[model samples]
Target: MKTSRILAAALLAVGSGLALHAANAQQAGLHRTDLLQQDIGLPGREAIQVRVDFDGGAVSIKHSHPGEEVAYVLEGSLEYQLEGRAPVTLNAGEALFIPAGVAHVARNVGSGKASELATYIVEKGSPLVVPAE
Candidate 1:
C-alpha cells in the first residue's frame, strides 16, 4: 500500500540522518595514545604523557584534567579554547598550559593532521582527564 511505502521511506530517512550524525560526532574527537605514566616520587603524585593525533577538521569534546596539563604542538596547528578565555591558535613547537579543572577543547584547525604531546601532573589513582558535562 502507499501508506506502507511512505512509512518505510520516512523510517529510512530518519535512519540515514542518525547515521550521519553519529559519523560526524565520531569525527569530532582526536585520537589519543597513552605514551607513559609513572610516579614522580612525590607522595600521591604522578606524571603522564599522551600523544594525540587529530585528523583534518577533528576536534575534542569539552574536558578537564585532574591537575595541570601542558601540551606541545608536534605538527600542524590547533585551536585551543578554554572556558572564560579567548581561543588560541598554536603552531608546531608552541606549547600551552591548562590549569587544573579548567574545561577546554582542542581542534585541528588546519587542512592536515595535527599532532601534540600532552603531559599531565596529577594525583596518583585519579583519572588523568575527565569529560565536562
Candidate 2:
C-alpha cells in the first residue's frame, strides 16, 4: 500500500456557522506553478481536484485514491495502474477513468517528458489516498 497524505483534516468557520473543512478558494495555474491550492476544499465544492503536470519525468508509481478519477493527457504520455487490471498507457489528448476505492499506480511513460491534467470529484472529507491496498 503506497500513498501520499496531503492533510489530516480541516474546518472552516463563517458568519454564524461552522463548516467542516469545506475548501477555501478557486485555484488556477500553469506548468511551472507549484500545486497551488487557494482553498483546497472550496466551499460548495462537491469534491473536485485538478492537477496539471508538465515536462514530467523520472517519476515513481504512486497510488492514492478511494474514489473515481478522470485524467486527460495534455502532452506526452502517462503510464498508470489500477487494482485487478494491467497497466495502461495514455498519450496527449487521451483520457482515462478510475473507479472508487481502487488501487492504482501511475508514472510518465513517454520517451520525452510527459504532461497531464487530472480531476477527481467526490464527497467532502474523503481522503485522496486510502492506505493503498
Candidate 3:
C-alpha cells in the first residue's frame, strides 16, 4: 500500500508540473512580429500607433529593441535631426530613415503646417517611444 501511495504521489507531482508549464505557455507573451503603423484592423495586431505632428516637432526618443522607422513628408519639407549624424531635409514625396535606438527629431521647415507619415515594424511588446536622455 505504501509503494502504491508513493507512485500516486509521484504521478500527481508530475501532472501538476505539466499543468503549470501549460499555463505559462498559454499566457500572453509577445514575440517577434511585423506591425504596420496603420490601424487597418487586419488581425493579431497588438497596437497601431500613428502620430501627425503638423509643422510641430516632438521630443525625440529612443527604444530598446531598435526599430527601422521611415517617414514620408507629405505636405511640406521636414528637417530631421539625429544624434551623431547630420541633419537631413526632405520635401514632399521624399522619405528618410531613422536607425534603431538613435535619438532623432523632425521639424517642418516649410511654411504652413507640414505633415509627414511614418511607419515602423517593431518587435512585439516594445513601446513606440522609449525615452532617451
Residue 40, candidate 3: C-alpha displacement in angstroms:
14
Where does candidate 3 stray beyond 4 Å? 1-51, 56-65
Which model scores highest in TM-score? 1
TM-score, every prediction: 0.77, 0.60, 0.56
Q: Model 2, range 16-113, lDDT digits (tens) per residue?
A: 12211111111111232224223345463344555655344544334555456787887888887777888898999999998777777666777777
Q: In angstroms, give how far residue 91 of model 1 lies from its true place.
A: 0.3
Q: Report residue 84 deviation for candidate 2 (angstroms).
A: 0.9
Model 3, 7-52: lDDT tens digits are 9989876875565354333322211122344433534333333434
Worst 10 residues of 2 by lDDT: 19-28
Report lDDT (Cα) of residue 133, candidate 1.
88
**Which residue pairs come into collision in candidate 3?**
none
State each candidate's clash count.
0, 6, 0
lDDT of 2 at 65: 58
